[model samples]
Target: MFKAIATAAFASALLLGASTANAMIINGNFEDTATLDPTGLVNGNKLSNLATTGSSWDVFTQINGWTTASGAGIEVQTNRTLRSVDAHSGQHYIELDSHPRPNSNSSMEQEVALDAGKYELSFWFSPRNDDASSNGIEYSISDDLVSGFITGPSVSPLTSVGAWTLVKALFVVETAGNYTLAFAATGKQNTLGGFIDTVNITAVPIPAAGLLLPAGVALLGFASRRRKRA
Candidate 1:
């Protein structure tokens, strides 16, 4: 009986340790709490804290487990709506000037780090209108802001001028550390605009010993009683 109890306790401890270890925030809210802001924000937009250099935007904050940011130049009123349960956000429309000669490229960007592993990154975004050929946004990721960068899970070309769209991308972190995430406005240069929201990066949870130990001990005792009867 004692051996069974001990075994159960040990198993429980292992499971608990695993759960506590795995459930962590690679990067929680973008308060710029860390002095490393690889992804700069738009000036005048709301920001939680200044990125690295103590420079902050005026368009982002943690409102009920969500971060919001927007970048709209002098043209038509535009903004980006972003929210995340873990640590992700998005936006809506950002109208840039005409294309080619008068192209208006208004955008916002962020940087985060992760351990080398398989991750599923997803976000909800939309352009001024659902016109992939004419209006949309482009996103890219790089190991370093200077070099060694990989493309996105899938660069979504704006096609539907709907209310909001959900886009997903899968990527592996070859090296753990900081990486730059860039969001750009793509398509015709005239009156360019868009929005992004609810971005999240989630990894599989490890098992928790606390949850397992009790079960193991109970099983062990049942086995021992049966053995004595036999």
Candidate 2:
């Protein structure tokens, strides 16, 4: 009876560990941008000359799976016009600025299906060369705010460009539902604020169960030896 109970408990622990290891978020890399219209905003108005003075248009719509929850719409930038230097990965990335319009806040968000568990979220961010020192962006999970920042390496066409920086956060979901993962631009918004790429979400590893696997195996081996001696 004792051996049976121990085996059952160990098996349950292993199953829990495996389930929590499953990744729930998809397209965290921001690489799937098939729905984005690179030409202009949702209003079908192009910025005219994006390479010159930046765009004056505000995108108040969705880009791929992400939507503009607040402020001006989000801008999808490619490295074609020499506007962007290097993308964190892939050929596309998102520019979180409303540019040509000062003090304007632009936000982008995506709703993901989540299970009840604690999750670790991570993404890469960078500042535009034209980004103002006073302007910044905020990261949020659901309605809970995570981190805020305004300073980073600038990816400007005029000055020396810098590499992207990784940002990480942790949040808990008490219920299974669609949760919003959002990034909002704050402060004195201009044509430059923040850039985002390579978003990732993973379940936080439960160390207790992870450690139990080897211990459980050792216990089973010891039990077998006792049975042989008996």
Candidate 3:
């Protein structure tokens, strides 16, 4: 009886732990920015302000809590006029391809400390223009593996230039530590690649039903022991 009771308690605790996990990402919305100069440059990276600067800016050098993992970093677009594509949320979004010239290859990364568990990574992405095609964005956890990729629509403007599609990936960490989440652009490069916004990371829930297995095994062992003694 005591063994059965203890098993029940253990199962309850496991269920509780799974339900209480929280998000670990910071500045996931990409809404915050450092002050831009008169030339629309932030920390040497030119931010898109609807004016043709005839130069491209780096994204890693500007955004807080993020860094350029590869290529020339990324570009931040804020000009509503120049942007036929709208942001998924807030007033700004990030272009994976840096400007001056469109880059086919670019990457960005952020460092986050997380507890060991399953996590769901999600973000909203869209093409820069109707002509953008074959461009792909790949996501990785801890920079160790390429978890998944989102490619541009086979047909240009599948929905609209700015219409966003939510991309999601699930990953598990066996040990708790600081991990680097990275996004890289792949495939053919164009001025219009992919835009990212509203990135999020949250712990995946462990079903309460899974806890029953161990509890059932414990109870069965307890019952068998008692019957054997009789």
Candidate 4:
């Protein structure tokens, strides 16, 4: 009976200690100012704003220019941010004559360097167009250069475009160090109306073996104290 109780107590102590490990934020707030940003986007990542129709996607001169909007839904809370770009309605993007509609032919992405470990990544999504289209968002993670279609999470393809919605996915890192993350939204050429917002990634805390050793010693001390009292 003593052995069983001690084992249970030690296990509980270990669990408690492990849960206390600090989960470091490797990449946050899409603050990386880089050249050729969107071209390096991950499989799923983006941010945008909404205020009725006819407005195009916002683009900040620099990532430092990003800020949160007021009275937005929870999905738009963190992972995604606002921008004023060429997003538009009526099968046309960017009021400029050269840009096409539906913004489907276009994609947006950003990059960040992150430490390795388990992580919970989530973001808000909303279609800029109410038209019948298969517009959807996707996220990708990579250790090498942010190129090609890196695998991660994605909103269901063939979606009901238009209106706002939140999407999230979890990923684990096998090794530690610098990596590239991207988000892309694509559709038929000249389709128009696509937007993304509030991209966020949080590291999942991993239990450390070293943390358990002290707890084990504490458990042994408690057991010894109980014996003396008895």
Candidate 5:
């Protein structure tokens, strides 16, 4: 009887560990208080922190949960900007391209460690301009930066403006370690780019675990029945 109880408890614990979805992205919604400008204004925009060094656009060295991965820094946007809309969930979002005055596109990356399994990454993307040449963002989950940001989870010549779109990508991990999850601007290197927000990553339940889920349930039921009889 004691052995049976121990086995059942162990199985239950494993099930919980395997099935729960964990949110990996920190400060994902960009709502966490960012380093604010002293006068609540930047480059004629509402109020936000400056990027690494660009004086023509809005960028940041760090946010609530992420840091600047490449090319100056992370571009941030608020609904208070000229000809802009509200963020997907929070008060701020991201722009892949920064500095309209002839600068290369930029990227931001976050690294996450995980066990061998499947995971899902999702975020909200919106175009800031109506011109097709202005909106393009490429996203990837890999250890190294994607080759020139050539990827599918990307927007090229994205013309739809001010409309928020949900983008979800699945990642299959063969070994447990740190993985780089990144987003970069593609197409023209113009200042205009895709707006990103509500970034989130979650682990997918293992198929093998699913096969054992029924067994875990049955064992739990059997354990309950035995307890009642005792």
Candidate 6:
């Protein structure tokens, strides 16, 4: 029992010494504006306000941690434009329709370097318009490049207009490598809806080895403590 107490103490000490996480994938919250400017998108270049069915919106190809996979570019909006809907979290959010007007049918993705483990993808989704068909979005996490389709995550927008719904999907990475996490507009592709925000991907809780590592350290520390006490 004494040794067990010592182990626990040692483990706690080690945890305290550990530094904060240094993980892959940035701008998960879409708040990293040092790269893209949102103000330039005022009523952005849209054909129908896109948000309102008869307005226009601008498309900015540069988002901090995301890349445009299709369509004209990525459409970002503020409360000042379109549906005038507030973001799910920060001051900005994404609309997948993008530019080229009518129905850009856009796709935006971010590449992440991850190790072999279970990871979960999460985001808040909402519809720009009441039309359910136009609000569809299909999220996929596939192997980096190589045109592979890995069905994962359901972040499709709901019908409540500005009512954002949280969506999550869990998937496994067989081997450590770069992977593509993408979101594309589905259904009608009317360039009017499908809003995404607070996008995040994180490795699931550590597997068995994770627990064993700290336990191993604890055992060593307990042994050393025992020798000292003796």
- Model 1 Cα displacement at 184 (Å)? 0.7
TM-score of each: 0.43, 0.63, 0.67, 0.42, 0.65, 0.65
Give model 1's TM-score versus the native structure.
Answer: 0.43
Best by lDDT: 6
> Which 10-residue window in model 5 sums to the lowest lDDT?
216-225
Instruction: Give the alpha carbon lDDT tens digit for every residue of 1-230 in model 6.
Output: 12222434355335334322436657776666666544334344432233343333456666778878987678776554644356666556788876556658888888889787655565666677756666777777775222211111233211355455555554567788888888887756567757877776665565434542221121111110111121
Q: Clashing pairs in model 5?
A: 51-59
Judged by lDDT against the true structure, how good is candidate 5? 0.56
Candidate that would win on TM-score: 3
Q: What tens digits encode model 3's per-residue C-alpha lDDT throughout 140-216?
A: 78645226666555442132354566555556667789988888877566545777777877675667564322211
* lDDT string, candidate 4, 48-99, tens digits: 3222232322332223323212111112112122332221111112101013
Model 2 lDDT at residue 75: 69
Error of 1 at 157 (Å): 8.8
Superior by TM-score: candidate 4 or candidate 5: 5
Candidate 5: list runs displaced more than 4 Å: 1-22, 34-57, 144-159, 206-230
The segments of candidate 2 whose C-alpha lies over 4 angstroms from its true place after superposition are 1-27, 35-39, 42-60, 81-84, 100-103, 130-135, 145-150, 153-161, 209-230
**Model 4: residues with Cα > 4 Å off, grouped in runs:** 1-104, 131-134, 143-162, 206-230
Comparing 1 with 2 on lDDT, the higher-scoring candidate is 2
lDDT value for model 6 = 0.57
Which regions of candidate 1 fall more than 4 Å away from where they truly are? 1-101, 144-159, 205-230
Query: Model 1: how far is 171 from its true place, Å?
Result: 1.0
